[model samples]
Target: MQAECPRQPPFNCSCTLDNVVWDTSRLYLIPIITVDCSGLGLTELPGVLPSNTTSLLVKENQISDLRPLVNNEHYRHVADIFLDDNLVESVAVLEGSPWLFNFRVFSLRGNRLSQLPTYALDNALERNRHVVDIFLGNNPWQCDCLFTPSFQVNTEEG
Candidate 1:
């Protein structure tokens, strides 16, 4: 279900329209299980979604905070989220939400995150230790005493 730019893209878009559709704010819904919206003029996610959506493949966009996405009914079911190459500076917006804990793969490869936000991870479902892959490669991880050895071992071997 992963989609990419076919030829001269943002593939589904047309250069003839002067890319006007990219400016409008609306939900891009499809019955597919995966979607890729990279290299678009998107600064934020569209305001709505279909509840059946699972994997949202938004690798390169202008999105930063995840707070706004909390209200989406399908937000809880998102397990594989590809959110690399964005403007996300901090993971604070992910806090105060209960649904984000079930996430199994969260990729933040090219953002401005200084440290992996452990606050939300600590509060995750205790029985749900299934969070497997986390990509924090390009960010500055704050490796400090507060980041005990237990935290490292509990999750993946970052």
Candidate 2:
């Protein structure tokens, strides 16, 4: 069974429904939703997302702020977030957010990041104790005193 994607206003994107489950008594399709909003030249993220969305792809946009992902309740269940080739400069907002500790896949390739909040990320990784894939390639990373040691530690630990 397949269900049509819900019409979310203010954003145009493609949706794929996977992992379909059919319940005989309920007569409904339970789908794992993946929302693809890549290469839309968007300045911000979509205000609304479909229920049960687990993967969100918003790469190649102009999104710089991650407050929405941290502050908004709509993204509580999202596990995989691809933000490659965006304008994200800092991930400080993810300091204490659950997304830092619970995300399965978080990609930030080809962004403008030079440094990272090592303390928060280290704490989150320690707490997670789960296998997570984090992509940070293609960014202009500055290998300075503050970043080198922490990066080495995180890499060794992770």
Candidate 3:
């Protein structure tokens, strides 16, 4: 059967509803919605996403701001977000964001980030220590004294 893509604004992307096994006790199939908008040469995230989107892939784009991700209600259920090779410089927008606290996998690999808002990231990691995996590889990080302590704490605890 053909999967119906969720209703959203026009963007050069594709969506899939894959049957995934949820809890072992329940033994039921759940449709996991994944939206792929990678390598589209976009300067920012799409204005809206499907409400049921669980995974979002927007790698190799020119997106610099993360405000949309934090402000948009459509991203509330998203768990995994791949933003590798984007132009994102700061993650301060995610501070105290509910989605960040519940995220399972957040990849920012190969971005233009030099410094991080430690409190936001630290809190998110602390809250979801076992489940969340945040990738910060390939960024030009400034490991100053201010950035070191929190980074050390997360590294030691994680």
Candidate 4:
């Protein structure tokens, strides 16, 4: 017999964790699964995620490190990720991960990121510049010599 995915009717939560109900109805369509667990006060990413998750919305939480998400085979299909209003200090989680390849929209607004590794953004740009939309605002950005070249180029281009 095939294992059945349990359904909770009262709250309409498809997946329950730590008494927090995850509304799985936000899933737009088959190829575009959107799991929105926003404003749940979550400290970390959920261990068991839907294997077909394409857009993950986990904003307004206390998630600090994203390293745990790197090895999760379930996250391989993620394209759009919204991690705003969290405690993310660094994106070392995506430093060398293959997820950077298909990563389309990454919004880190209102986080603790100081600087992003240009190589990672460069890789995403190399893949598809027009499809990538990275939002990095409302953080204490470090504008040092490391940013001189790119800053000058972008300033000139702008």
TM-score of each: 0.65, 0.86, 0.83, 0.72
Clashing pairs in 2: none
**Which number leads on lDDT?**
2
Q: What lDDT tens digits, residue by residue, belong to model 2 across residues 12-69?
A: 6888876777878999977788988888888887777778788899999999999878
Q: Looking at candidate 3, what is the lDDT of residue 80?
A: 90
* Model 4 CA deviation exceeding 4 Å by range: 1-31, 128-130, 151-158
A best-first ranking of the candidates according to their lDDT comes to: 2, 3, 4, 1
Model 4 lDDT per residue over 1-158, tens place: 01111122221213322222345798443433566667777787765555466667888888887865578776777678889999998885676677776677878899998877776666656676435577778867788998656634532422
Instruction: Give the whole-model CA lDDT for all candidates, comma-separated.
Output: 0.60, 0.82, 0.80, 0.66
Better of 1 and 4 by TM-score: 4
Candidate 4's displacement at residue 10, Å, is: 18
Q: Write the per-residue lDDT of candidate 3 for residues 21-135, one digit (tens) a residue.
A: 5767888666677888888887877766664678889999998988877888878878899999999999888888887788888899999899888887768777864445778
Candidate 4 weakest ten by summed lDDT: 1-10
Between prediction 1 and prediction 3, the one with superior lDDT is 3
